[model samples]
Target chain A: MQHSDYVELTSTRLNPHVDPALTVWGWEVPVYLFMGGLVAGLLFLYSVVVLLRREERYPTVAKTVPLLATPLLGIGLFFLFLDLEFKAHVFRFYTSFQFYSPMSWGSWILLVVFGVGGVQFLYTLAELEPFRKTAIGKWSVWGLFKKISGNTRRKLAWWTLILGIALGIYTGLLLASLTARPMWNSALVGPMFLISGLSAGTALTMLLARARAERDILVRFDLLLVFMELAVILMWVGAMAHGSEAGLEAAHQILGGAYTAVFWSLVVVAGLIVPAVLEVQSLRGKWPHTVVAPALILVGGLVLRLVMVQAGQSFGYGA
Target chain B: MTRTAHKYGMVVDTIACVGCSACTLACRSENEVPEGLSRRWVNQETRGSFPDLKMKIWSESCQHCENAPCVKNCPTGASFIDDFTGTVQVERDLCTGCKACMASCPYDARYIHPTGYVDKCTLCHHRITGGLETACETVCPTSAIVVGDLNDPGSEISQLLRKRKFEQRRTAAGTRPKFFLLV
Candidate 1:
């Protein structure tokens, strides 16, 4: 295989050099992150309603959540499945537990969330004493499960809360674990995703709350979460700016570079700040009951995920 | 009798390169790598003023890092450094095509196959298992690329690595890369 003479190059076009992985992961990943956050956030709220015994005051959220949370989680898992290049090998995610990989943490957390969330949904159904004695309930194990009583439900609610928090943080840690992408390298990313998840969850529940008191309370909490979300985003950027060049490079793209316009206008202004102003006006009775703010919050949460993934990929750490 | 542990590594003599693309051809043919993607690539980086122009050739691929961020970051055990030779290898059947390893690697060495698995330079593990040198190292026209077990004091790579000044790729990334560019 040795050649003594210098070999001459022919065509350079055959092996064209390209930038490394600025577009490796695309839209599907962000969508999955958003949905996962939403599920975690929603279930956390559901746990609050059940464990805190606030179900009487927020019956709309309490009743609907058991039904809503699991399916939303399923949809999020579906998006995760869609992103996998090996669709048939989806079962591999469950085959082992890898502590080093954040993706491993996510798979296990997501499964636990689904399991606890599904059980909670069933328990909520069985708790209905009137429905349990009915023909529909006795058709299956619902009648026997109805005898499970309040103690099991409480245990499940506690499990749900723990797993919910894990799942929420895992969404951000998933990307933050990628040290190669300096944009995502931060200890604060988990809290950032958690706060966003809370805000998005509040907004999602507000959309379904039919009671006057429930909507009003959610609006107040949603506004608080939105404020916290904005603050965390600023803190994240500031911390990155103070530390390393790679972080700054990533921060530059998101804060002032190619993504500046869309991120600020679509994500910050229309999605967050404007909606916050609208929510404040409604709280002061300047405007009537409206879905605009809550809707905007959800959109902003999704934009956060999308922008992070896109700009983070565009950023780099190696030559 | 047991096979002795070997930390196989490579040193590329950048000064001797002729931009031949011969190593790339050898890698492709040996590994049966798909088109439009490669386990290795050649790039040119030019520096200095117009009057003192100089160009450097970078035949880039997986660094086969000692710490191996890709191995740690891979959810499955598919991307692992071989226990016998201590060179990285991928289990194609075990890979789920999640691209976690690909994203985690700083070198950008891995790519997804059409059948939905990640592939990257293994330093020709198939041939090395039978006591053969890597195809790229064997076919180099200028004898620019050298490979051997760094742990063995008698090996060619160790001797070259000790006498020559070399720079590692992305050493600051904390990956502790094994691939070296002999200056």
Candidate 2:
């Protein structure tokens, strides 16, 4: 058999940030994603608790978690701003709305979240004894909230729920919409991030809830979310495996490539599986309820974003 | 038949290229592209075994696609298609430097300029709009690079593409790139 060996030598003025792979988005992006996902989970869970009329049973979730949404989202936005090369031009995002751009959609969605979430936060604060005595809390806005009917508040809760879901999915869709990067091109990324966000939110709620019943219910919900997240992760990888050449290579990136160990150990096992197992045991009364499970879940959720953002940038069609 | 807008494009005669990188240098000198960054670059590909060999060299840059993903994905209206020339150009003032356009570009043609804006090949819009050839085209020793309005049937680029066999890079990306490489 005759053998034919092929070699190609090419050289160009290399742009380090773009050439072999796009490394433009750094730690700031992942941090922003993690924070955004956390807030999304908090908003979704708070809205659900309100809609179910379970606020009495889950007072901490109803009152405390809603207060954290705006602050956490603010932190996320700050990190996102830091990642911008032209920091002064950040306002340009709001100047014109490009319908096809996910970042545009995200900026707008976040604005709505802040507005509705702000109202929700103020209402929660007005009810609290510490806030009622505060100088700013004595303002007329609390009186305005007082006149808002229960039905109208429920409608507000519905908006919060929808916005929460949108914010969660938007975090993933931001990357998924970019077809240039094969790893993030899958539609499953949206649902995956949403589920993970929900799990993180539930875990945080469990950690803060002083009532035993609240923690018990949240533990079960977090377990279910963990399972859903695992399924979505499988579907995300499976879809990539069965996709085009670039996509298959993208799947390999986390399956056994550079991201494999961190992805499996930090994100899957430590983040999802272990927390799930502990929560199940706690439900069975075989394990003592501790902060370990929820803490693991929060860490896992952060690691998931870090891995996805970094790994997605490590490969592309050009790379 | 009515005359339409000028659809600017480029055709590179790979056969005639000598891998001298004169085009890349000329482009840098003319554009004042910042240090360690370029709007265009040269590629040299060699294939086959020691017994038989084939080499192809060509200058490459942004395709200025009719369906540019950068334009579609830019959160701000910074990256846009020029109406008159039908070329992809950036509005520096509107760019947020979010790097979304860079991530969306399959050609890896865009880079963050030192002035903190995403920049890429404009197809020498500044020169071509004034009825002049691009810096690279003017300096090509072998006359390997041809830039013209593809909408004009008699233009050199259109005529060359019609007469010779050519290939566009990453056509599957659905960018509908105008940069053609003659095989």
Candidate 3:
């Protein structure tokens, strides 16, 4: 075939492998990063409970949230390995240090978070077991409770929570530093991710609070956080829309492409509006609607992550 | 001994690129790039319709910038260049495939190779050091692609670049890339 006049015929044969990548970032990477970001945010907010609230009221959660969060972050890293073509090659990150690479920094940060968080969690659980005994142990088992929550476990929990929050926010900063992707280039991304983590963490905390605290408290706090989360998301989307042309194009692709339905339905209606109304009702002592709001908000927050990860891919040049 | 320095690059005439991807294929054979991998590519733009249809092509590869971002951001020093010769090379053994270099590059030229190492065009450093031209330039049917040291005033690349107007991608990114497009 005759080559076009305006285009270059710069090689002997036509290249056969010129198609666009099919599964932009694949399922594992997007899901894993989202999970990691959420875990980071959640762990940070949980620390606030430890540092701010009275020891008697917040100790149960402050002691327990790290136990849950540390594991999720660990699992998130496992999913990250799935994105690699050669999974074992990831180990090289530790053997050789590269200060300029974000991945190298991110991996190290994750490792520290997990290591410190995991030990602290186990320590706090052991400390709690002593209190679980006596009349409390009469309901449970005295020996088992004693073994899980022993003495000397006090300071570890606070340290773990503090480190976890710092690590989580750093993860958000890593993604924001990449200027190549206009969609991710905004200064808003790091803070947005931090807020997202708070939303997810609090949603999970509220779910747990339903069992531990009064239904009234759970319903009120959960609904309020849901409203705040939704507002953050809207601000994020609006800022993206008004940014650079490339950024706007990226946002439109999110609105119209694969992420559209999830953004509008799950994040907006399910995560925010519905929850806000139900929470308002809960504040007014309307009990029945409160249950529905938190559950929907949980599901909606998850959908928000799926949409954000998948949305980044749609910005690729099809040609 | 005086150091022998070379800064390799390409001069593509955007007006002559047909989007046939011939340069891409030549690079694969010359460099033995894996089946699903490529060292060069052409971006196609289609506009208008029917009899008034028009398409433009922008051929791309590693721009080999004077201020290469990949070299700057590589964490393990896996992605580096010869300070004397200016030939950027990747040390596969050291690469962690963290995809950090991929993000730092303004042109999106770098990628995680199948071997979990970073991969991209290296300007055929081996062949050119043997006093041969780049595969893309040697095989170009229309002679649309050129490669040489921009520092060499007598080189064809330097002459053509000096004689005609040229453009580089993402000028605002301030890469000062060696590659130029005669648009």
Candidate 4:
């Protein structure tokens, strides 16, 4: 018996462009992007708390985030370093910065965050008596260093404030810089990445937060970030759907094409709406599970980058 | 910042292209473009119904744009225009094989090599600098590929372009590409 599944098409044109496919970037890019966004989110959240009120003790929150963030960033950067095909010539990135290249800006920006953020964050930590009594504190002179004053901490907070936002925005700008990919080509990527990072960062902070009050703050803040993320993503998709031929096709890829299932199931349901709803329920005291939203947010964050990177590369203008 | 001395360009007579794969083969052998990846190839656009089919074969390669995205967006100064000829060239040593140029390039002309650096058609820089044409131009059976200086008014490319109605691929990108297809 012959199978009776005949796919009918109104138009079947054999129009092939150069290369006609995208297999250049691999898993490393999405992983790097996720890590970069996560670190940026962590720094930004910590800085925001310090900026809001440097004196108020939010013990289970970002006060100890530096310990996690500094190392998390290092692991993220290690992935990037490993992904470099010619690792020996990585120094060339630092030789001369191109104004036109976001990668150039990113290299310098990552350097500043790693150097200044890492040092100051560790210094901020070592001043605590528990850390001061540790082997790491005794092994290093950084512990002996004077704890920064309120004024200095405030100033450091401001610096991290600016740097953290830049790092958050840079993650999106990295993709947004490529004009060829319709999914990546948008001003919305900036805010989208920033908000998503904040949401993910808040989720992470909530996970680490042992204090009920701290978790409450993180949960509420993450809810706001989730709403903003949802808005930014919708705006991005809507703009693309209305923008150009290539952009429309790209929207289709997510809305109801190759990436349709992932986009809806993972990004929309799992990443955005579900997290927001969970946070909302937790906020209303209807659900005590504060851990669920943040965990889903982290998973969503990874999937967002992965699906976009995959879809954007597949969507081309000329083809 | 110093500018190049001349502007290099290419014009392919698509009406004459036989889709022989000769140019792609010549480019591979001339440039030693590894085993799998190619520096240059032909794109066939087939349209209309069967027996009424219209096919336009475009011999595609690096466009050598005046405002090249690859040149602008490359993190390292690996992908750059040659000062003498104005043809975009790569300094393999400077390339991190980051593939930024590959992603930025709309033409998909750049590729990552096994040596951990990007490689692309230099328009046969060695030969062109020596007052000879590109190997693709030299071996093109129909003389479909013409390479010359676009800046020189007396140049053959400028003269042909001035005489004929030509079109460029993806002009909307605003790259100000040097490749021309005689209409």
Candidate 5:
């Protein structure tokens, strides 16, 4: 049985230290986590292509994507550490094995994804041999080239894609699991990441596609992803606006507060809108703008993540 | 050693609060809290017509909920509720400072302290272990704060609840906080 009662009490002296005003913790954490989630999504998309499909056309871009992601994750993690009072003791989370913690789960997932993605990239380069039938070395052939160039490699590529997507999406689910932060507590956060990651991944793929003159297929795919990402962003923002007070504050901080310009103008406008328009133009048989659109979309996707992470950090869930 | 399910909690009488700021000093002294930080605090509210305005004070801190959202959202398992004492304990060493708990808490009960570890009220677990009341309860000038077992029908908290009604902070959040607010 449940009962609701309002109890009354008598006079007691008060304390001054507990200010009724909100604290700083609300603004910093969510934003930081959002950035990390986006970084993971972007890298996963880039790596899956290189690792699973053997799309080894642009090796430099493939490797650079992960390198770029490494710093974002590291920096996001540092902000989190410093926000918590710069205590080294908190580092024990990395060492302790707790199945229930969302942080532990997220950290572990990131580590595995990054580790596997990195190795997969290096292995791709190793497979691309320049000696078997080189124009200058036609006289001597080595068997090392044959081992990495077959269907076996393609199957492994598929496995890597599957793994990367799973890890990439898990990052969002981990955040959403916390029901208290209603902004992040929705089931959509997982799909949000899933869709966003694909869009970001597509953005990255389009960039590479343009670089290697494989623009036709990659550009269309990137355009579709940008469209999908826009939908996800709308839903994500709507969810935040409709949730509890904490969630509202978190959303407000992003949509109308500190994160507004970056989210609306940069992430939504430059990132999604410009690219969407360019994509439409291309679909209408305008080929010149197709190249520029994917590049803009890529930048936009990165900024979108930055805004989400920063906004999450700016709000605290409190009464 | 005999183990007991303590279910320790606190009851605050808002009517008896005088807004004197003494419990703050006592808790700070007992915990050696950093100069800028406090483990317990009071929230003040002003109500009624301007000439007839009334003052209300609330002592706010961790409620040590039976179903703490902070503990669940802590990705590092750094925050936990001690089953033996019902104290929400933050393991500084294990905290990643991800601030996931801070975001997830409906009452904003947890904070990343200056020490980089999540910090909040611990229900004076150390004091209670030494056969003493929480520092806040010990120093309340008007006996406005009562700490005891809510499960025990004879305990002061339970008795107060049975005879007079009380409120818990953010009850809708489903935290089931052990701290009771008496109006």
Candidate 6:
């Protein structure tokens, strides 16, 4: 007689959120990553504008955006803090640093970004007419701000640019370094995330820029960033597809697996392609400029992080 | 010549295990593992058809790898290798509870303790350091579980490996796991 053979597991290994699948990270992490990317993009754009001596040409990019960096980063850090299981012990991140830990590198990099970005904000504030008329702006620090010449601003810009790039890459490296999640195992994720951030930053700048020339320049730059983002994303998925069994499974998750519809609809079509087409139309003088395109890019940027973070955690070694 | 330090590990005889889960209970009691969580558990696998069927049962827990990804990924030096015994251990106070170690572990061996720290099988570090066997090894009715120093030639685990054909879980992960399962 023929019989069926089966394997059964019976034990008390009931660890919540970890047994059947890893669900340790939730929405908090993606939100934190999104905000971090946004700040990184803003800082990078601000630094580039200053370094190229385009402050006169792109005043909003050079002045207004840097002021947003410190507050945006603070929001991101708050969400990161919320994700920590031990909230009181959060300060321990700074006490000792593990060289191999991407989180460690990210934490330290965030601190440096904050310091540099804060200084840049102060300089920007000192130069603003509305702020200069305020009481606090009349402080003796105004003397130091006045002493900051074009050369010092350029040096600061260089530092901000390097730090911004580091921060942007670090956001992606944070997930890429975790080899346990096969979905994030590719080396291309860092550059992909960096490009995505740059695209988001460009979109935000385009929305905020008052001058048509600034908007035109950002529209073209964002178009290039969006294309780069799509290419890197494709390369990442292709690399995963060609990787190990688990890697293939990870690739399948986004390609045609559970995340297929959302990844394609929300992230790819609406977030990237739609925004690209809109920007292209604007460039051609066929579509009137509005907040819709840049707004979509920002939304897409957030959805990308949300999808990647959730999908990466859902599958691993055995899955 | 300098003497190599003791590398504590475990060996389980799959054929000898009866799947009673005594080891799992013993571990929970010994480690005081929190509710709804366990440091160790039993798994039963049955394969083949009818008269040709074969069944194997074994207990599982942290592999305590020599190249543990959890230790490497911990940002705060919280997850670390115990110097006295070459086994992985977590410094509870140092852990920020970031869960990076949780995501990095291929074995899924760690869990965030209810008290806001990452906890896992220390191989009964307290008992082993006191010159006693792990609670699971001590309480296993079939004597299927063996815990000892892999570095010591005369140790039970070393002799078992020498005399028996064995396999490890997910060697492809390149973690160099110390947990062994005798075939």
Who wins the DockQ comparison?
2
Q: Answer with 5 or 6, whichever has the higher TM-score.
A: 6
TM accuracy, model 4: 0.93
Candidate 6 clashes between residue pairs 3 or more apart in a chain or in different chains? none
**lDDT-best of 1 and 5:** 1
lDDT scores of the candidates, listed in order: 0.80, 0.88, 0.64, 0.81, 0.64, 0.87
lDDT string, candidate 1, A1-319, tens digits: 1333223322232322225335767788898888888878888888877888899999866787777788888887787778788888877878877778889888888778877888777767877667778888777787555565355777888887888889889889888887777778788888889888878888999989999898889889888878887888888888988777677777888677998887888778877898889988988999976788888889989988999888876666745
Candidate 5 lDDT tens digits, B9-80: 888888898767678778878887777666777777665554566666867677888878788777666788
Q: What is the i-RMS of every prediction?
A: 7.6, 1.8, 6.4, 7.4, 6.8, 2.5
**Model 2 chain A — which ten-residue stretch has the worst lDDT?**
A1-10
How do the predictions measure up, each by TM-score? Answer: 0.92, 0.95, 0.80, 0.93, 0.79, 0.95
Candidate 6 or 1, higher lDDT: 6
Name the docking class for model 6.
Answer: medium
Tell me the spans in candidate 4 whose CA falls farther than 4 Å from its real position: A1-20, A54-56, A148-151, B1-3
User: In lDDT terms, how accurate is model 5?
Assistant: 0.64
Query: How much is A1 displaced in model 6, in angstroms?
Result: 25
Error of 2 at A80 (Å): 0.2
For model 5, report the TM-score of its A chain.
0.66
**Residue runs of model 3 more than 4 Å from their true location after superposition:** A1-18, A21-24, A96-100, A128-162, A210-228, A288-291, A317-319, B1-7, B15-22, B43-58, B65-77, B81-88, B100-112, B129-131, B151-155, B170-177
Count of clashing residue pairs in every prediction: 0, 0, 19, 0, 41, 0
lDDT score at residue A151, model 5, on the 0-100 scale: 38
**What range of 10 consecutive residues in model 2 chain B has the weakest lDDT sum?**
B1-10
Per-candidate DockQ values are: 0.39, 0.68, 0.29, 0.41, 0.36, 0.63
Kindly list the per-residue Cα lDDT of model 6 for residues B126-180, writing each as its tens digit. 9999999999999999899999999989998999999999999877667889999
